[model samples]
Target: MKTLPALGDDARVRLSRQGGFAAIHALSRPREIEFAQCDISQRTRICSVLEGCLTLDSTVSGRGDQRFYQIEVNYRSGGQEDRMVLKVPEDQAPGELVHLWDTGQLL
Candidate 1:
């Protein structure tokens, strides 16, 4: 379980996994994004500019195998629902999942 700094105000937070699976929770809302073995060759990425609250669910899986080799994130916010799916290769390292909430800002 990895915890990222809160995203500005409004009780928002971000989290990610390195080589396994990870989940994120805000209050009671839950959302997710993941990177799997098959994702090795595929590039999985996310970018968000929030006007309100944004929630997402993403999954990455290995090819040929029905079971995803890895599960990365699950997150939820205080708003409507949004979802995304990405396919990646099995050689990519999981470290790629780490990303700054607001890239333009300095920590």
Candidate 2:
């Protein structure tokens, strides 16, 4: 399975030309990642969020009594680059996790 980002008033869409080469033959850059599994039964669902050039990749996985939701985000701005990885238990709400990330706190 695949997940999608929420689109609201802050969302805008743009298109970029990435096919072919300017002069000689060149390969087009890939814009999306392809998952190895196509069938829903063999796939795990996740959500993606794009804020400016920043991307938030989130997913949930576990076994037995342990389960967790993980989020990975990385971006560059103002000549500085940053990355964050967060994992929240399945029993917990994602709001608090977002708050922690917003505050630059890690757990």
Q: Best-fitting candidate, measured by lDDT?
A: 2
Query: Clashing residue pairs, candidate 2?
Result: none
Residue 41 Cα positional deviation in candidate 2, in Å, after optimal superposition: 33
What is the C-alpha lDDT profile of model 2 across 1-107, one tens digit per residue?
22333322222222111212242222211122123322332122212222311222234433444444344433343445444444444455355333333442213
Highest TM-score: which candidate? Answer: 2
Residue-by-residue lDDT tens digits, candidate 1, 50-100 = 211122222444333322212222333445332222322324323233223
**Relative to the unseen true structure, what is the C-alpha lDDT of residue 84 in candidate 2, on a scale of 0 to 100?**
45
- What Cα-based lDDT does every candidate model obtain? 0.27, 0.32
Q: Can you tell me which runs of candidate 1 are displaced by over 4 Å?
A: 1-61, 65-79, 98-107
Residue 48's lDDT in candidate 1? 30
Q: Total clashing residue pairs per candidate?
A: 23, 0
Give lDDT for model 2. 0.32
